[model samples]
Target: MSRILIVDDEPHLRLLYETELRRAGFETMTASNAVQGLEFVETMEPDLVILDIRMAGMDGIEAMQHIMERDQRVPVILNTAFSSYKDNYLTWAADAYLTKSSDVTELVETVKQVLEKQATAHG
Candidate 1:
């Protein structure tokens, strides 16, 4: 099973993503802020990271940079409430970019697709 690190400031989102991803058969871990997420990236070495664009401190863009610096191979999915960040060049660094929604089906599908694509590339 692939391990996914979910980084978001919202508690509900963390729980929701964790629950749904677990149901989908992926192992999951969550960080409430970018700083902790970066730490987890280094220590836990998750196969993929689902990062939020905006947080109280150290936004996802900056955190993604740090994560890439540590290990470029790990895939990152930028999950944000704001669609405007999609136009930003920094977000392009992520393997996938998804806008938040009430329904999480898209998010789950994207995670599966990204991980599958990564497996193909590395395998």
Candidate 2:
């Protein structure tokens, strides 16, 4: 089973994403901030990460830089409410950038695709 880490400040959004991803057959873990997210990445080493940009402290882009420094192999999906960050050069490091939505269909699909692609590349 592929384990995915969800990094977001919003508890409800985390739960929603966790539930949706779990239903899609991916194991999910969540962190409320970038610090926790990076710690989980170091300790748990999830297959992929769904990161939110506009958090309380140490935004997703900054956390992503740290995560990449630790393990570039772990793919990151930037899950932000703002589309403006898509133009930000820092977001380029993310494997994919997804704008948050009430419907998580696209998010789930992106997760599957990224995990599958990364698996194929590694194998």
State the C-alpha lDDT per candidate.
0.93, 0.93
| TM-score, per-candidate, Cα-based | 0.96, 0.96
Q: Clashes in model 2: which pairs?
A: none
lDDT tens readout by residue for model 2, 5-119: 9999999999999999999999999999999999999899899999999999799999989988873568999999999998999998899999999999999999999988998
Off by over 4 Å in 1: none
Tens digit per residue, CA lDDT, model 1, 58-122 = 99999998888874579999999999998999999899999998788899999999999998998
Residue-pair clashes per candidate: 0, 0
Point out where model 2 deviates above 4 Å: none
